[model samples]
Target chain A: MELLRPDSAEAAAAALGNGSVALAGGTELVPLLRDGIVRAEKLVELRDVVPRGVDGTRIGAGTTLAELEVDPDIPQALREACSLAASPQLRSMSTLGGNLLQATRCWYWRLNFPCYLHGGDTCHAKAGQHREHAIFGNERCASAHPSDPAAALLALGARLRTTSREFSLVDLYRLPTDEERNVTALEPGEVILELDVPRPEASVYLKAMERRKWSFAIVGVAAARFADSIRLGLAGVAPIPWALSSVADLEQATPLLGTAYKVQIARALVRRAVEAVSAPAGA
Target chain B: MVVELTINGNAYELEAPVGRTLAEVLRLDLGLTGTKIACGEGHCGACTVQLDGVPVLSCITLVHTVGDREVTTIEGLREHPLVEAFVEADATQCGFCTPGQIVTASALLAANASPSDDEIRHAMAGNLCRCGTYPKIERAIHTVAGDGGGS
Candidate 1:
């Protein structure tokens, strides 16, 4: 394999496609590559190619989760999400962009099972062990989106700029379709450049995990309060980070046999997240 | 690819594949067996190493992507207080995860000299002790940090 270290973002974008993958922090991509889940003939390094650091409400895509966790300028929900997303070592090596693009933690997919996401006809988790699978949007696939920060960003009403165009962060994710098995809306060779988040009046992120620390969320909720409205985003509930129109919409969940318990967890977290964000400052 | 890496304060030019992990290059090529590789994936912290003083999973970090950065393994932490503290505190069981644990703890204490018990747990959360020697590991870190130790 060839390692291409492009000095600029344009060069990095140009180097992508045609059997080449973009390398950012290498937290997610490297493991997939090593396990033969994803294949690439070349890796285009983006450490130096993409921008870093925060300028007002705009954050560079190259910012590490550790850096995002402590930056005073970042919103409280995003910082908390970044801190609670992974272990210390992983946060130090994972970038915001990479975190958003990370694949699900479904063992079936990671183990190379012929699931729907792997271009197979069956959703393995739906018929097999799916205790950690999705509770919503699981008609076709049972895998849940594993990103904590994506949920927070979705609640923050974040927008992002790519190499070719700009769009809301919500547009960045989609449920896997028969034509495209991938969950993300990003086309081939497209690269995320940066994100712009509007400051919320108040925000809170709550997550429930199997372990006390360093475990993926069984149900994560991000609630952001604005001047006259509130937005909630959920993780570990669907194939994509799910945005809730209202808390009542959670009732629309159609859980699998083994995943029925997640609906209760999501309800509890969503309640607490809403209460926390709804409280007055310092309450 | 020929990559220039600075490991343990020494610079060396090594030829390795672009897909080869930093842990593989350290163990198989440079013969630095101090850095253990248990999972080969980033799930286990057994392959933890310091990249420019920040703890990172060397198993997932590509060797070619580590250009011009200093890599520090357990061997680089010679005579560090945590090493002795680990012995006095009995922080090892099979000693397989010792190097990764010490490397991670050292970085934590470097940034915060007087971390609370909660801070210590949060920082050391990644380095799993399958033998359940967590209390002793926390004690060792606290001992070096000049604290009485955690609850």
Candidate 2:
């Protein structure tokens, strides 16, 4: 029940090194605490440090999803992804760093049910109602990574800068195995300082949702095409956003449940996004 | 921990419990009943409030994170033109989501004095009206936008 408001990222990391979790935006952490999914006795408030340090390509960790939605410097694909994420109010409260680090939104996990992630013997979603769960990378778990912006970030080839180290957006996530519960590969005490989002020549983000607005993606695609290379990212069908090397890679995909239909949707989306971005400026 | 919050231009120092949501502190501790709490999660937008003029969901926002920033709840709203527009347009059907709708719409109008239909729709997409008064709600916002929101 103690909170430490650190003035700098280094101090925040120091507190985190001491076992205090970082709280920013609180869009994800507070709910977990309320639901008893995780317990934290001490917290390091990065409120002062998270909003600083932004450039044309670098976005501060404290930047809210709503801020990213309107930032002109961010690529169109990333902005579109942020805009499509959550509702407006939630976006205003959710930070880019928090969104990337937020836990899976699987109903079983959020409800505090004893599942595989919670140290239960088995993943209940594997056998239970998993229509909204993952379709790819369901080796041991079926929960999909819930962050919409993560897919766009991955497609943009974004790099995460922490207090101590830097890593690609793709390296941040890991599919759960039988032993580990942590989703992100970030080591303890590492505070995400900023995200380096490159402005591609052309990019587009498309999220297939159950609703027109404010629903998680059934299959999200972010495709960015440079003059020389192409980058594609997929969400809602995997434990992590799959940053594919090419469109043909979709053929290697193994879908969970009857959501193989998602592969067709994903293919169409990738084509649409690539076409939208690859089109001439006037065309 | 002692947390200082500036709500409705009034400064108050209160003992904030760790993991306590801003919605709980506002309604339970500070007695600001106007900010409704429907979905305790961040989805509903029923607990929308202005954190330094930006709309945020208090249901998921931790009270300790408020720090010294100003929070504007529906109770603190001072009869703005957006409220009047809602009344004129009969935007409230069930009245449960009206507070959040008005609060969110007010932020939108404040940022863009003349938001178009598409802009209005995108800006207010977060606040759900299960009563299906979205058309009416957008109309109310348009009414205020055309009038410059009473300046």
Q: Backbone collision count in every prediction?
A: 0, 0
Give the interface RMSD of each candidate.
Answer: 0.5, 1.1
Candidate with the greatest lDDT versus the true structure? 1
Report residue A78 deviation for candidate 1 (angstroms): 0.4
Worst 10 residues of 1 chain B by lDDT: B142-151
TM-scores of the candidates are: 0.98, 0.94
lDDT of 2 by residue, B1-151 (tens): 7878999998888887777788899999999988999988888778899989989889888888887679999877768877888888888988998889888989998999888877887888888888998888888988888854332
Per-residue accuracy of model 2 over A1-283 as CA lDDT, tens digit each = 7888887888888788555778887878887877777678897888787755358799998888888888877899889999999888888877889889888878888888888778777788877878778767877778888777899889899999998899998899987777677778988888998989887888889999988788999889998877768788887888777788888888887776756778888888988888887757664
Cα lDDT for residue B36, candidate 1: 95
Q: How displaced is residue B138 in candidate 2, in Å? A: 1.3
- Which residue pairs clash in candidate 2? none
* Per-candidate DockQ vs. reference: 0.95, 0.80
